[model samples]
Target: MTPPLALDIDGTLTTPSGRIDPRVFELLPDWDAPVVFATGKAFPYPVALAHFLGRPEFVIAENGGVAYVDGETAVLGDPTAPRAVVEAFRERGGEVGWGDGDTVNRWRETEVALSLDADEALLREVAAAADGDVTVVDTGYAYHVKSPAASKGKALERVADALGIATEAFVAIGDSENDASTFAVAGESYAVANADATAREAADVVLDEAYMDGTETVLAALRERGE
Candidate 1:
């Protein structure tokens, strides 16, 4: 059976500055398998990254709250909180804005990329002001506020359902706090050398080297799996 693979963009497939490694780019066209771009980035960001990775047919973006299949966007469940929830969070003296892929992310002439944890007092205050059901995940960059039900694992399940494959057929790779759940649930998982301690703990394998080499490592793993 051919294995299905999912790749994270930022620190896995690309450099810290977001450039795709040329050597890895050369290998992508020769790669075989149903590869998915599972990233915390938004639509266009991941799309650009996937284009670099050989235009994968399926993508799980916005931390798995949003999915793009054959170029169509399918929002599975509520990835973002309701307007009221956002309002309540703001009421608690916390500044909330749209992040990375947030279509509604319009703030200070810059695209909102989520929230930063400035102080524990502020974190508690924002958590309290929001609807009790909000899911606040640490994405290394910021506090990702979403519905408790939205996650990369759930998004992977959707892709599996669409492909008529079991969850065990998937391999997930990532390198940050946001990738924890995705890594935790995948049949096989890998963490890049640049991954933080939290990401390393959740992964089955810690990549032996940094970003560019990590892509090569992942491709090697895929080839071994007969992808």
Candidate 2:
């Protein structure tokens, strides 16, 4: 049987040039096993991606602050924790930079995500000193301000339980520090060749090819073995 897949978007499934490869949208739905899109993106992004891809809406989003499985959504973490930190960041002259009517966060439920264009260094400094247990993660494409109560590792266990599969049955693929948590909990994990140091260290295998090329290689091998 094919092992279930937990995949990260952005740098993992995208081309080296950062566009979502059409091949990925094709391959994911064809996989015989379940596929969960895990990411620092908000819930709607993955839900929408799965719908458009005709894949299952098993998603771990907002860096695990929110998850959707079997059509029901479970929310974790303190929604206000990161909001407060962002406010502090702005107070300290850190502009969110997304400007008015920011659509990226309009649908988010449990945390604040800033564009990489935002001041990463200032945001981290502010989040670290903020009250509560929130933290910042750099996902290459963006920066997320999220609560410690939420993490992809912790959320993956929930996904496993609801699917009636062990976390060890899932193979995680990703390319950022945000994906490190899921890598820790998965039975096997692959870091794309362009993966950040944190994800590389956490993964069981580091691929030779970069981006979606790496993903296709891994998927091809798994399907060949029928596991």
Candidate 3:
């Protein structure tokens, strides 16, 4: 069986601005392996991306809370935390950012990007209210909180299981903190030079280029595997 190719969207398949090269899209469908878009973005984005690339077998969305397969959207994991959780956090002065809910984005979730002025006490309260199940990530700007079950790694595992591909026969490419866990199970993982330091540290190899030139980088790695 062809290996599963799990590609991250933000900084791996496209530029930081979220633009995909048509050339890459052209090459993707012909690839023998199954392709999955593992991303933190909403489900629609990856689904549209797959449509552009002409492949729709699988697409993991909203960090992994939702999975799209064969034109059907399945909630892989429970994204609904009790309303009390959010109310409790808010009561303690933690602000919440409401995201696209069953509309254009079709993602019913709330996000937390703590204000720079937020104190540790407030953050602690938010953490306590979440019961530690929220994803608290420091993106250098602020701490982000999302569903605990949503993650790129978990989504990759879902795709691997669906395709009947062994975890060892997977290639993962990404360039951000969200991509770290997924790389752990990847047979080959790559980080672009433009990637942040955290992403570089997690990847198996760091490329000296960008995703626009990713075809060459991936081809080189494949050749090395044959050697």
TM-score rank order: 2, 1, 3
| For model 1, the run of ten residues with the poorest summed lDDT | 104-113
Residue-by-residue lDDT tens digits, candidate 1, 82-159:
344545556766565444555534311111235564343555456566656565556665565566666778888787
lDDT score at residue 188, model 3, on the 0-100 scale: 78
Per-model RMSD to reference: 4.2, 1.3, 4.2
TM-score for predicted model 3 compared with the true structure: 0.76
Judging by lDDT against the true structure, name the best candidate.
2
- After TM-score superposition, the amount by which residue 77's alpha carbon in candidate 3 deviates from its true location, in angstroms, is 3.6
Model 3, runs deviating above 4 Å: 70-72, 82-106, 109-125, 138-144, 214-216, 219-227
Question: Per-residue error at 19 for model 2, in Å?
Answer: 2.0
Predicted candidate 2 versus true structure: per-residue lDDT over 1-227, tens digit per residue: 78999999989888878778999877887888889899888888888889999988999999999888997889987878789889989898888778899887898899888988998888988887876578888888778888888988888889888999899999999999988889998999999999999999999999999999999999999998894
Query: Which stretches of candidate 1 lie above 4 Å from their native place?
Result: 51-56, 70-72, 79-112, 115-121, 224-227
**Prediction-by-prediction clash tally:** 2, 0, 0
